[model samples]
Target: MTMPQTITVLALDVDGVLTDGKLYIADNGNVMKTFHAHDGLGISLWQKCGFHIVLISGRNENSVTVRANELGIEHVFQNSKNKIADLQSCIQAIGCTTEQVCFVGDDLGDLSIMNHVGYSIAVQNAATEVKTASDWVTSLPGGEGAVREAIEYLMKANGTWDSSVASMMQEHANQ
Candidate 1:
């Protein structure tokens, strides 16, 4: 539980972990992706709490870049076949270490980073092997608020959940 406070960055895999593991390919070679609003909000909250976010994916998709940019996530490494190496580059750029990172994914491709991170998380839809290697598993499946669930769980562990909620509620009340 205390480990959450030590987490300074979150490295996320895009396809399975963020988009239901499906690729929508149009007949004309167009690609599209759907992302959960809840997950976006969760990322915003995490950033507001002063944490960094990094996006890592094997496919080179414009949609992923757009989404990452929209969320203000600057550490985007798309088409990264070597997630662990890419993550290491990100960590170095951010001046953090493996011990300050939380890696979330749903496939075997993520196993390396999952094993190296301080806290590893897997979506409900993650493969059995991925889940087995994770420190925590989300109740919701990926692309369906699973990222949000993971963020909430971490916030709770870091002793910031109540305060974050109170702050949001107070903001709403003031409005």
Candidate 2:
């Protein structure tokens, strides 16, 4: 599937997309989530190319905030029961349109926004219905570099992958 040529924002669903959809709760009732480092680097690369990233999750968790901060993502909407609404607000705040957004999801909660965005992507382990509704499906499963895979696909589609990689390499060499 061809990516939307004007994509400027990447909206992500956290639980099933950034994570494996498994919630590890301690005896004290704190929830823990594991994020892939590869995905983090992918986000960094995407940002380096001057694109935007947003996280929208139905459930609120502190770890999500921590991770988003670590990645320097400014638009994060947790405890969002209505993802479409949150997405709209995000686009408005960022001065972008839905036609410039690509949403990556892995479950039913992600369906509404998927249909509204310019491009919809599903992780490999996503629900069958989600995959059916997606424009593209990643080869890797969620929490296992699927987000990174999606980022790479988007970068390539937008014709920014080669230059972004070269820039990163140059920066690393300078360091």
Number of clashing pairs per prediction, in order: 0, 0
Model 1 residue 7 lDDT? 85
lDDT value, residue 137 of candidate 1: 92
lDDT of each: 0.88, 0.92
TM-score of 1: 0.94
**Cα lDDT tens digits for candidate 2, 1-175:** 3356578999999998999999999999999989999999999999988999999999999999999999999999999978999989989999988988999999887888899988999999999999999999999999999999999998898899999899899999999
Best by lDDT: 2
Residue-level lDDT tens digits of model 1 in 38-60? 99988988888888889999999
* Candidate 2 clashes between residue pairs 3 or more apart in a chain or in different chains: none
Per-candidate TM-scores read: 0.94, 0.97
Flag regions of model 1 displaced more than 4 Å. none
Q: After superposition, how far is residue 47 of candidate 2 from its true place, in Å?
A: 0.7
Q: What is the lDDT of candidate 2?
A: 0.92
